[model samples]
Target: MTLRLSQLIGGQARPALSEAWLDVHEPATGTRYALCPDADGEDVAAAFEAAQAAFPAWSTLPPSERARWLDRLADALETRIDDFAAAESRDAGKPLALARDVEIPRAVANLRFFAAAATQFASESHHGQAGLNYTLRQPLGVVGCISPWNLPLYLFTWKIAPALAAGNCVIGKPSEVTPVTAWMLGELAREIGFPSGVLNIVQGLGPKVGQAIVDHPGIKAISFTGSTAVGTRIATSCAGNLKKVSLELGGKNATIVFADAPRTQLFETLLRSAFQNSGQICLCGSRLLIERSAYAEVRDELVARAKKLHVGDPLDAGNQQGALVSKAHHEKVMGHIDLARAEGGKLLCGGNAVQPPGRCEGGWFIAPTIIEGLGPYTRTNSEEIFGPVLTLQAFDDEDEALALANATPYGLAASLWTSDLRRAHRLAGRIDAGIVWINTWLERDLRTPFGGMKQSGLGREGGQEALRFFTETKNVCLNLG
Candidate 1:
């Protein structure tokens, strides 16, 4: 299959406005699959211009009409589901089942959710007899969205759906590594007859194209999903212009299994949480903090389960854990594995890469790694590895578990597995992360607000709350005397 990257601007594919280009690789074989144009400042400016021009008309449309466009876009996406999944798997090393079953479906659902949410933007009531006052939700004009490589389609939809639902034009900058699916989405938007300039996509490196988008005066807000470091940079740039910014950054999330928790159930939940998408999730439960009494049993089960995970080609139907995004990411994950050893963390099981039976040797595959005995301050415990690696730690009591869970700078998400209802409620309240799951990990409802509390990120990204984030409230007060 041949994949070609194109800039989607003004409702059409256009020629590259930049001189540079990069190869999008197929991680399973370490081969270049397509040449993605590296957009420069001029290209980003053009996208901004498109969005800025479209904003007035698009935003003026009634909320119900805006929703119809999103509904149409969702239908369009559904028609191309298989193609989207295949490209997602090839471009980002996601397992085919995951792309088909989880990512694409979730993306479609997000669009549908936002379509319904768009019509709920009624004016806020003010209990004041002094004057008639109500707040109107208004779009922020143009939103410049930068999505990460991991779960590119899902993250892109997370931003686009709400931005459009709130009646804003969007200029999206997907990660250069995983631009194929995002570009295809832009094409689908056009096919659905979304007005020209309502949505635009420019593929390029962050330093050049991303910076341009952030710096563009025409862009009223910046929504980003990526590493905390890059998020900080984007925040700084937005601050210079006082542009509205919402970021979902890195995480070192924890999964605390209490003594009363069902051991088998917790083990299975952790298995899915820590290794899904090879643990490339920002909200993945990377730290497993089991109650001291149940630590031995949980660790034993986890190690056995980790060994059973299938590591192989993403295209393979049976593979559970696939390769990291690229050679660079694979090496980075290996470096963290080496760091774990240096920090005196015992390698419990599966620290090295494995070429699956009958799979090519060149695939960027890494085994499900488990390490134990690392101190809370150790790099293995403190940093976000963004790979299929889980670190184990034991906590004696509830307070210690909560402290360990909140120790990291990140506060993206956390999970508590316990049959004790009181303890579950108490810890769920105390955990500093944004989303706390009781007896589950990484399970989310589209209608609930989702985001981190601390350095993890700055704002929420789901449901009516997310719609508010994309819009500014204006108060219109009039007096009739």
Candidate 2:
């Protein structure tokens, strides 16, 4: 029997008011394991109403009180880490170990981080001779958080935890592709006696539930992470309403390697940056720009290492790579590989789809793909394939490497491998990406602002930025005698 999931609204888990349901697939086996609500505008309206009703009281609570609740939520999430990990792996087709060690733990960390940040979230005060000017940061009444399917609960909590920690009531929309863990969070919220209507989870397709959240006037702000295309549409809708929106969108990041950098670390992190989570991470370095002096050596080693990555069921401990999130996404990645070939790119390693033995045979799995002979201007090099696909480009000098790194429409992140401190510092400044990692990739510091430049995304999130984004700022002036 397939389990039926519920929409969480008003601190209750119930079926959507509408009878329609969406089939929830377990990507590992291409099987339907559950069903979630195909929520419509009515469902969204209900959630919005609940959030709006809860906003005043919730926002009025002391920051310390909010922090306490968030801390409790974090504690609860940690207690059920195993369940969340298992659900995340089944829901998003990520390895169980990856979910346990990274994704779910990160979600718990998000709650704890924001919990601590809430008490520290402060307003600004300015001193002047005649008067005092102070800036107040207050929560937006009811906010929307729409998270993508790639990281499921990890990104879901990343958005909502801050909103809640900032004392705003949130109506969150998790991607229909992987909604289980999010639904599970709702169950936790209810069990912990989290105030009714403080956080609501609406499950369904983007056009239905997500669009409703965007269109609703009651939702004062939106924090969204997804494809650039979807983010664009959400921006358009929010523009007319003047609703505050924070978009963390797509990325075609670059990984640059210099000859003098540590070879072992470069090779190891390079493979991970290119192919981890099957390269679904928006921060993944899809473009590899190598200094000519080390191009051939890095390229050959990368190809050999990528070929060895095991592709199988997500639950299997031995497998390093798991199924793509869905059948449609799998086809999209495969299509991009085919496009690369047509564009005159040579496959250096695994480019074809893989049907691993056993249960994952019918799963959506793509082998780690590395392509060479692709110019920086080619679609395969510049576009965000968002799969286990990497394109190689050789640069002779710092100027060329910087140009190649900044060539794409996206400016989300860039990873540079270099022993020269001056070179790293100089390139870090010139690189258009929002994030520049020297000799490292995916090393996150929660305090740093995270976002993208140009078409990658807009605004900033993380730490104070996230807390501020979910709030409204007002400046007040006082006369001093």
Best by TM-score: 2
The parts of candidate 1 lying over 4 Å away from their true place are: 357-359
- Model 2 Cα displacement at 293 (Å)? 1.4
TM-scores for all predictions: 0.97, 0.99
Candidate with top lDDT is 2
C-alpha local distance difference test of each model: 0.88, 0.93
lDDT tens per residue, model 1, 281-307:
997899999999988989998899999
Quote the lDDT for 396 in model 1.
95
lDDT of 2: 0.93
State the number of backbone clashes in model 2: 0
**Candidate 2: worst 10 consecutive residues by lDDT?**
259-268
